[model samples]
Target: MPLDPFLADKVHLLDGLDWPQVQNDPQAAARLGEYLRDPGEWTAPDVSVEDRTVPGPHGRIPIRIYTPATEPGRALLWLHGGGFQGGDLDMPEAHQVSAELSARASALVVSVDYRRAVDGTHYPVPVDDAHAVWRWLGETLRLRSGPSGPVALGGASAGAAIALSTAIRLRDLGQRRPDALLLAYPFAHFPNPALDADTRVEMEALPPLLRFTTEGIESMVRNYVGRLSDLPPSAMPGAADLRGLPATGIVLAQYDDLRPSGELLERQLGEVGVGVRSYLAAGMTHGHLNRGPSLKEVDRSLDFLAAVLADGAAAPAEHPTYNG
Candidate 1:
């Protein structure tokens, strides 16, 4: 299939700023953050947003909670993606996605501001922060609809990896697990030669704007893993024994470099008899869900999520609809 006309245009319009360069240059990173922080990116006007902190392994972790005005409350614990190096609660990828899901699905959304690798905080730290918040949300907190409302774990990119790991961890510890999972274009696995070869070919066939390089992916993984010799299930969900994960909704972008991994995850879940639903957003690339109000597939994912939480409809869609 050819690239979607609109996304092809978006690719050409890209500023062509390489992520590795931005990470290495402080001024450029700051400027890029500022540019992405535009107030105009905020979406879902009907969702009410609030900021609060929860106890973390070290001090406090910030979180943004989004509540919709009319629907019966279902909750989601969300993490944002930045290759495990960048992103924040107020950023479009983090806040806007949550707000859109909350408003459209009438589900309460909680976005976590977990620690990143750039902060000299490596694998377990970020995962630990997520775990702390997950525990608090399950045990100590109550939603507007009280404590019994269904809560799921979710994230985009690295955040999705974290959510999946958190679910695995909760099951291992004999603690309550989320009712479902919402993973959007997740960075579900570390780089490997076979996967890398396939992704490289797919990326070359698509636009160059969001193409990923093996060197870049390796660098991000090194930053997250540091000197760790063995990665536990908490650090890498793909390395875990995933026999009994919760009902899951996975959204994959058609032209995304990570799409292969997302598909692999869906198959793995199914092989274990774990209920799973996956959406391949045709004509879209990675991070399309982060566009919030600008993309229809984003709403499609939220709709799937609402259905999963309301009633465990964890069956794959036959032919997904597109608003393009």
Candidate 2:
């Protein structure tokens, strides 16, 4: 499969700047805060986007809500990616996709401020924050206009992984899980260096549009989880039982090292009769989806997501606004 030309160009374009430069980026931190502090130009005029906080074990868990013009309160949850270490709800890369989801899916998007790994081990911090938010939304949020319709969940990279864990946890507790799941190059599983050769090769290419590398993935896992045993289905949801889960949309990057895991995740869920579908983005890499307007494949993914959220597995959307 050939790569989308729009994304191919951005790889070269972004290469001009060093990834390491943004490795522990101060600018990245700033971008994460921009959506909360200013909220300017981050949303469309037809939609309402705002920041709201919910009570968490840690104190106040902040979430940014983006609602389409039609509904005051539709249900949706979006998580951002940053290796479980750093990411803000306001980062342009993070908010852009949420904004796109709001406009295209016609649902409200809530991006959470789950704690990062800057201080300790994986579960209790990031996962705890996510779990707290999940429980609160289901038990306390006081959702209006009837039962929560299409409580879809989605995220990118690490956020995708967290989203995976959150869904698994919700289902395990016999709580209502997201009506559907969308995971883009989800950081679902560790390399498992133990996989057979055939499996290893397949896992090597993620969505490709997202620009993931075995090396890059290794770094994120090492920085966040530390070791294989330390990881959890609460963290690596793919490692957990996916049976009886919600309808799922798994988006894989063509060039990402985590591709096979995402595929494996889809297979596992499907085996459990958990209606599932996957989109193999031709010629894209890890991190490509975050580029937003810079890549058409990203737009396609957003539209595909919107269509699914609004219409279910009816058909692939040709554009962002398609309601059919």
Candidate 3:
């Protein structure tokens, strides 16, 4: 399928934009935000939201907690994506997704505002923050002992890498793992898997701003891990030992360059005997979750994630794939 007509019509909003420049310039960043902002006039469902900080490796980690009006069904800790350098709790990917999941799944959602890979910051910092929050939640919520409902860990793009890395860290440390994992258009590999011929041709029609060029991905990786040589498997985790990780739910954008990475991860997980559910958001681009739930694909993707959390880590008898 081609780009969704809704997004294709708005492609002009990102004309002449550069991501690195957008990162450094507030005006440029605002323009990119405007282009990614949801155009629908829908409002977020009612959910009690609280802003709080917890101790982290470096300092306090800010997080937003969302609680539904009804009884909580599951507990989720979600992180937003910005190539590990941008994004915050206010973004639709973080705010709207958390709000919707809280209401739709009746889950208690905690959205982390981890430190970005800026200035001299590097890998392990963001992962450390996420791990700290997970430990804190474990202590407060009694996740290890007899507790309330199932708990899930999830994220989008670079944040998904961090979530997986955190899961790996927990496994290595002999800590209790999350009941389930949710990843949305995850960038799990440094040198991403090559796109198929059909996908390559399909991506050629995308605007430059919507494309993740080789140079751009390399730059993002270098910024996050400092030097690209001797890269840590935990930072990317595409080639890491994934055995014993929780059942995973992945959402891939049909038109995304990073889709191959998510697909590869699904295969890798299945090979390692982990239950996996993969969903392709047809006609959507990367970070579609960043758009408001008013978009049909975005809403469906969120629903899939909610269902995963609701189901926990139980391995399905067979892998299930969804095309939204």
Candidate 4:
């Protein structure tokens, strides 16, 4: 099938922009982050945003909290996309998504700025920072009080990878788990050059205007895991035991290379008898949930999150579901 007209226009617009190769270039990553932080490209949703730092294993972790007009007992801890290297707290992918979800879900949204490996922050650091925030939010919100009110966890791309890892860590430590988990086009597994040839070919088959630079994607993946031996189930949940995780919701982009892993994770969760639902955003590419032009899909994702947070109530029937 061809791309949607709106999405095709978006692809054309992106092709005209200047994007540097971030492979081995920290400055390029920084520049990309700055480009994404432009306020002109995003309108702040109607939500109160705050900046605060929480104690972490090595140091303080910064987080932005978004409070909606209608107060609710529940909250969501959100992690932003950047392939575990480039994203920041103020970027639209992080801030705007948090704001919109807070307003639409009527739940407080906490967006964490975990350390990225691209900055030489390294593995376990990002995971540690995320875990710290989760614990702090749970204690702050008193999540153990009841089933109706608990902090949910989620992220986009690399952030989604962190969310899944943190959930596993918490469960292993015998700590309280999140009420639910949400993943948006998550790069949930490490790449296998040999086995991923078909995946790469599929991505390359997209309109030339819409495909990502090979060097750029490879850099993101390399910086994220460093060495293959370092890859653990905690960081890449696709190879992990999925039996004990919380109710899971995944949003996958039809044109995303990562879609296969997201589907695989859904199947793994189902095999373990976990409650899971996946939303395939048709005609969309990776990171569509973060792009301003893809507002319809973004709004739908928020609605799905809100529905999932409502305990004892069934998920709204409108969302297309792939339960596993």
Candidate 5:
């Protein structure tokens, strides 16, 4: 559980700060936005980007579409992460991850620009945006492909939390377990000391320290869920009974504090007899999936997700349940 010397050596420790301190500082959360803005003009030629929107409860929500050369007949519903406070579909990582998966699996990747909590969106608002986009895909876009490779949901950090709840709800409603789920440095654990020592160290290694702080996480959780529940899966993945969930591929950073949550979620999934694949990328930190330099791991995760989801469509006829 030692601090990632690579990260610790490169950055300053995040002394516990009050929620207002991190939120009002502005510069704290602004760093990620700055990074996104300066992500350079680099882009894959095979990837195509387009702007779109879907009707939501309050209003229409914007989104970005990344599609491959050939439509694989399945789409990935991606929710961009910003602690539910910051971030957009145009985020550098969001663009890259969506495009990477698109090219890898030849499926459509839709990134949602939901209402952020920074302006008091809170829980169900963002979660509702996710539902609106998903419903649009199901009803309008028609995500069903012979029921084998239906739509899947995924995201990072706060977005991952929203995706987890959305997927769980989808399964319980008997709609369809996403063919597959790709979660990177997923924010699973809530503000509790239940985490192991190693997990704590890994989370600290993540850059943009202010966004993932103790209070910052709580603020996101509070904003997402109006009132706290005894064990609300809406905020904490571990709180959910993951039985019947989709085939899950969790991409975690070895040095990320959130790493334990991924492993724990995997363990819980296994306990329920759900097929789970867990990948721990070495020398990486939370959000490393988007860090330009750490793209090697991110690429690996996307490739695996492509295969996993595509396999749902290509499964042997007998076991064609499409546990994607």
Candidate 6:
């Protein structure tokens, strides 16, 4: 499939633009925003939402909690993507996704406002924040016990990287792991796997602003970890020992440069005997979840995630892997 018609119609907005410049130029940024904007009218779902902070190593970590009107079947800690230096709990990827998942799966959703890899902040800060919240939620909500239902740790793009690192930390500490892991278009590997010929050709048709160039990926890694040399395996778990990790659900955007990373993660998890469920969002670019559920593909992606959460919650020990 090609790019979503909704996005294809606006690719002209990103003509001849690069991502780095968009950050400094208001007009360039606005045009990129226009290209990615959702045109549909969206209404917030009926879920109880609250903003609160939890104690962390650096300081208090901010988080948004959403509870469904009905009894929640499970709990999820979700992080939104923005490379590694951007994004917040207010983004639709964090806000709307949490709200909709809370209602759709009848699950308690907590969206973390973890520190970004900027302003002298680097590796372990963001991962530490996510781990702190996971521990807090486990203690306060009794997530480890079955009485409170299953618990999952999930995120999109860079957020997904943080979530996976936190999970690895828990595994190393011998702490109770999350019942499941939900990742969306994850940036799990440094020097991400090469794109196939077909994907490379398709990506060539996309605007530079819409694609993750090698330079951009390298910059993101450098910013997050300072120096790429002697990088921690847990920081990019694609190369780490993933044997003890919990069952995982990965959502890959069909037209994304990072899709290879997510696919590699799926194979890695399976090779380690970890059950995995992966969904490919056809005709979609990276970070589609950030657009909210207004687009059909976005809605379908959310539905797939909700179903994965529900399935994991219902049978934590019986998750089936799709290696092919």
lDDT of 4 at 125: 80
| Candidate 1 lDDT, 1-324, residue by residue in tens | 556565554453335556575779787576555533322344455878889999987779999888788863677889999889888997777887787777766777889999889867788788889889988876644533343567788898889998998888889899888888888777877653234574456567553437666777777788898853565655757767888888887877777777777878888888898888777676677776656544555557666655665555354344366221
What TM-score do all the candidates reach, one by one? 0.85, 0.79, 0.92, 0.83, 0.78, 0.93
User: What lDDT is obtained when candidate 6 is compared to the true structure?
Assistant: 0.87
Q: List runs of model 1 lying over 4 Å from the truth.
A: 15-17, 20-43, 140-147, 192-202, 205-209, 313-324
Candidate 3 has which clashing residue pairs, if any? Answer: none
Taking all chains together, the TM-score of candidate 5 against the true structure is 0.78
List of clashing residue pairs for candidate 4: 270-324
Off by over 4 Å in 2: 10-18, 21-45, 139-143, 146-148, 192-216, 313-324
Q: Candidate 3's error at 159, in angstroms?
A: 0.6
lDDT score of residue 217 within candidate 4: 58
Which whole-number lDDT from 0 to 100 does residue 300 have in model 1? 70
Q: How many angstroms is residue 22 displaced in model 1 relative to the true structure, after the best TM-score fit?
A: 6.3
lDDT values, one for every candidate: 0.73, 0.66, 0.88, 0.73, 0.67, 0.87
Per-residue C-alpha lDDT of model 5 across residues 1-324, encoded as one tens digit per residue = 354344445345334434465578776555434533322344573877899888989799998888677755677888877777788776755887788777777777889998887655566677778888888877655534422255778888778878888888777788755767777677777663245775555454345453355665566677666545564665576688888887777666666545666777777888997777656665556676565434445555555556655654222333222122
List the lowest-lDDT window of 10 residues for candidate 2. 32-41
Q: What is the C-alpha RMSD of each candidate to the true structure, in Å?
A: 3.9, 5.8, 2.9, 4.6, 5.7, 3.1
Q: Give me the candidate number with maximum lDDT.
A: 3
Model 6: ten consecutive residues of lowest lDDT: 313-322
Runs of candidate 6 with Cα error greater than 4 angstroms are 143-147, 313-324
What does the lDDT come to for candidate 4? Answer: 0.73
